[model samples]
Target: MTVPLFPLNSIVLPGGRIPLQLFEPRYLDMLTRCMKDGIGFVVVLLRDGAETGAVARFHPVGTYVRITDFQQLGNGLLGITVEGESKVAITRSWRQPDGLNMGEVEVLSEEAYAPVPETYAELTSVLVALCRHPVIQDLDMTVDYADARQVGWRLTELLPLDKQEKQRLVELRDPVERLSRLQELLEALESG
Candidate 1:
């Protein structure tokens, strides 16, 4: 199905949340339509350029997300928290007459992961710590994860990775592999 696209410099994994500001006319309209239709939009990583005006480069892999809560910022911009639903692949994309990026997207199925294994106990424990960090405190992060995949996505959100690294993590369809990569990255982080 076709969905409105928001290409930003950040990647949000399934079950993660991202705070967004809607001030541009195109996006403000998009947000209204989404809220009215009870649907969500796609958020892809901006491969190049900015979020507004000019058409920017985008990663095909993205997360479908819905606005969970909203408030008016002091400057009067629409501030909203978006919760990721699932992964989507952009089959094709084009700009609307109003400059909104619209895409024909495919909803990707999530692969089931086994429960968190003992090997990643340290990694899982650290996720709790990561959730309480000041930077993560604002996202309204969930501190509990039932499975390794949940842990992977949450850790993916918490880690201080570049956009490219985050895109890689978001694109990985295999939950176990995602967790394994997270573990490796955590190990490297500790060693560095």
Candidate 2:
């Protein structure tokens, strides 16, 4: 699958909401095309591996984001809310004449036979408590473990975690491993 790329420093997890300001001409064109075709674009994390005036490097793993709401802001800026749909891997990237980055991508299917591990229940309880704490409750987060994969992605995105840490969480295929990582993070936060 080929996808128009939106490269940013922010992490967009599956089932998460991302609001973007599209002011660059190239991205404005990209958004126009996406809206016309009723298709989504890929949101990839920008890394510091590209030179000046060059296309920024992006993590291979990204999520398909559907535009939920869009409005034209003043001065040719666009405000849009995107909901992440699924994870994808970039196979190749190329530049368009308008300075937009496009990529050939493959959507990563959800783990076929994996079941939500028992540990997730405990982890979700802990996370809910953390969210309800007076200090952090204003963060306005919602925790739902009905779908473990979605929960994992939400946690990975919402936490003030670094890119490498988020990548590690994304790469973990086993539910148990993912739950363990969440538990460890929560514990560390509690003890710190």
Candidate 3:
């Protein structure tokens, strides 16, 4: 299914909720369309250029997301939250006259569930701490924390990593391996 593309300098893994503020005319229209049709959009990290100007280049892999909740902020910007649904790879993209990007993408499968090592079970406390950030805290409340793969993805979203690193973590097929890598990164951060 072709959906509108919203490129940003961020990565959102499946089940992650990313909040966005919409004010631009093109995106407002996109939002109107999404809310009307029950369609979502592909959010890809920017590889080059800006979100509002120029022919911005973006990573082909992205998260397919649907708007879940929204409210009007005091600033008058439409504050909306989108929850990641699945991964998608852009086959090609083009821009409309107003500079909004629309892409032909193929939806990818959910990351396969691999049994996480028991040692990483203690990481749940760390995740709870990470979720204290208001922006992310709500997104995970509904998840089954005992599910190790969900734990891995939650950590992936909370990590202080670059967009590319987060993208790599999201693309990892094995949740067990992803957890292992996340543990290593956490250790490095603590030691430093």
Highest TM-score against the true fold, candidate: 1
lDDT per residue as tens, model 1, 1-192: 899999998877777898988899999999999999999999899999899889798999999998999999999899999999989999999988899999999989886866887878877888888887786788876655658888888888778877788889888877778888888888888899
Q: Which candidate, 1 or 3, has the higher lDDT?
A: 1
TM-score of each: 0.92, 0.81, 0.91
After superposition, the stretches of candidate 1 with alpha carbons farther than 4 Å from their true spots are none
Q: What is the C-alpha RMSD of each candidate to the true structure, in Å?
A: 1.6, 3.8, 1.7
User: 6, model 2: CA deviation in Å?
Assistant: 1.2
- Steric clash count of candidate 3: 0
The window of 10 residues in a row where model 2 has the poorest summed lDDT is: 135-144
Cand. 3 TM to true fold: 0.91
**Clashing residue pairs, backbone N/CA/C < 3 A, model 3:** none
RMSD of 2: 3.8
Please give the TM-score that candidate 2 achieves against the real structure. Answer: 0.81
Ranking by TM-score: 1, 3, 2
Each model's lDDT = 0.87, 0.75, 0.83
Tens-place lDDT per residue, model 2, 116-159, is 57766766665555567674453343545666765667677767
RMSD of candidate 3 to the true fold? 1.7
